[model samples]
Target: MEKLLKAERISYHADGKKVLENCHIELRRGEIVLLLGPNGSGKTTFFKCIAGILKHSGNVFVDGVNASKMKAHERFRLGVVYSPEKMRVAENLSVKENLAITGDVNEAVEFFPELKKLLKLKAGNLSGGERQLVVLARSLISKPKYLLLDEPFAGLSEKAFERVLKILVEKSEEMGIAIITHERVESVLPYVTRVYSILSGKIVSVIEENFEKELKRYLLID
Candidate 1:
């Protein structure tokens, strides 16, 4: 069977500058793939392309069906969800309202029980970490088959990170996850089934074994 979500020969350009060059990736259910790269490595650009936020030269296949022409909303309906690095929510709306726009608020809270109490609070009034949780919760409630998260651990406290990471591991059983994180790489190392390293908008290597050593090599850690 084809991978749940696949992107092939993905290349992108902006202002006549090539940002991504023939990048490819495959995500399978029951696995978490970690994308590691430094800043300005086209990490965010790749996620945007996969989420259909930006048009690029490539084909995106979802479960053997071509979805390259689908709009962002159309892709969302097809069970592909992307949570950006920055928090995105209606400032004036309450947390519950935000989640309700896509799916059941109660179902979303099941993943982050801490959100239950803050449901009534205006999204803008919450702290950065709280807002991140809301964004993640909303994504989870939609029950997407493939999830692309950009910097999901940003602004999260250690305790909160643990909670979120645990929930993500559990959710990976039902969905394929591709996460981009530059900090605390070791924290996510154990849970990831595959690792991809990108530099200058190109995937340099993919490691499925000897993760720590291989990852350090790409990261240039001594």
Candidate 2:
């Protein structure tokens, strides 16, 4: 697998307070990697940095291009897509309309056929899980080479969560992915090739072997 992205000695601060320090990570094409951490562990901040939404001291190379020096749109053109934990869809728009804006309704519907019946329904009226599926559909429209997801399965029921994971697994096999979440580690275990444990603004551990088993222990899998 070819290297898709790399972060070296990355650090971030806000209001004169250090939020992340000396963080390093490497992502390969066609790989699914998970970032595990508790709330306030800087997982979101780190993701923002990768998306070029936040400025930080260090180097982030996307396909060998320095992301720090590139604009967010430039990074997007490089196939880096970031989906925040919160849905940013247009509440008034129907599911189909929302997906049409990204021109990926067909592809997205394949992963989440439930959306077909809800295509004409307003985004604001859908359940949390439904809304998330729409957001994910829109994100994948760009056919991004790298996808960053933050707590994508949050607020979803067990069945919905499993469905989302299925879609993620399929997409990840087609592209490089980095997902951040503290729950359902076992659900994502089979597809994850690497795992990173973040603590107090830093990557405390990096495991590449038996990642699922290790993650189960760390996440206290029952």
Candidate 3:
């Protein structure tokens, strides 16, 4: 319980093969790690090599330093938040002015209270689940400690994917989550404790018990 995000032995190559060879990930703090794979499994190239955006070989500790010599906005000011997977709002601004350019949304409006009646509409006229709940309520008011979620349930709506796994399991106690999904680990199965799985490129399995019968016998879940 001392890995506030760590990637060891992470490998990658091109022009010659091997997309990611050794691959590893820890991420703790409060917990919530689930990086399944299938699409060129490197899980978004190990979240772009732990958000430093490419150029990686191994080692990427965050809270324990050595974050590839930090850069991506200094590892996002050391709090480290990367919510990609196509999430960017402010199409014309409005959902409370895009949470007022990310200052405070009263705890992301208490983890999205239907975004307080769509703040006042506009976010490009909302809808893909209210614009992914205003780009995940401005990434939960930018209070991340290590968030890094990617495909947040694609286009959510099984009640907004259970209200975004109950607001990232209450923002993972204090936020130290990592969720790159191809979906169906029974949808964040009980806020996932641990589940790796990446095939071809490495980390073949880590499931931490049952996990829906090991994603239906090795990621065949559909």
Candidate 4:
């Protein structure tokens, strides 16, 4: 597989305190990578930095092209789609319209057929699971080369989690993916090829599937 996204010697600071320091991670095309850390551990910060949502000192490459200086829209055009930590759909727009605005409803539906029926409902009116489905569906319209999702499973029911997980895992073969979550690593363990656990703003651990239990132990929140 080809490497799609790489962050090297990444560091960030705010209010005179370092938020991240000398952190590194790689995402290969068609691969799913996990970013696990406790709150304030720089997980979300890493995602924002890569998506150009925040500024930082580092190098981020997409498909061997350096993209650290690109604007968020430019990065998106380069095939990087970021689903933010908070749900961000039009509250007043119908589901179909939300996707239609992007001009790729059919592509989104190809991954999440269930969205077809919810097309008439406003995004705000959907349940937690349904809302996430809408978000995920809209994200695919970009046909991204890389997808970064922040806490996507939060507030989702067990069944909904499974449903979303299946689509994400399947979609990984077409795009590199990085998902940030603090718990329930089991939900993605089977699909992930590499896991990076962040501690004190650094990637303290990088493990493969065989070491999942240890990784979980290190990141398990009380």
**TM-score winner:** 1
| Per-residue error (Å), model 3, residue 111 | 16
lDDT of 2 by residue, 114-214 (tens): 88999989998988778888888788886888988888887788998887787777777778899987678776877878888888899988998887676
Please give the TM-score that candidate 3 achieves against the real structure.
0.32
Off by over 4 Å in 4: none
Off by over 4 Å in 2: 1-3, 212-222
**What TM-score would every model get versus the actual structure?**
0.96, 0.90, 0.32, 0.90
**lDDT tens string, model 1, 1-222?**
655899888899999999999888889989999887889989999988988899988999988888898888988887889998887888899999999987999888878888999999999999999999998888888889999999898889999899899999999999999999876778888999999888999989888988889977776333
lDDT of each: 0.88, 0.83, 0.78, 0.83
**Winner by lDDT:** 1
Q: Which whole-number lDDT from 0 to 100 does residue 81 have in model 1?
A: 94
lDDT of 4 by residue, 107-178 (tens): 778777888888898888988777777777778676888999998887677877787888888888988999
Candidate 1 minimal-lDDT segment of 10 residues: 213-222
Lowest summed lDDT window (length 10), candidate 3:
182-191
Model 4: lowest-lDDT 10 consecutive positions? 213-222
- Show pairs that collide, candidate 1: none
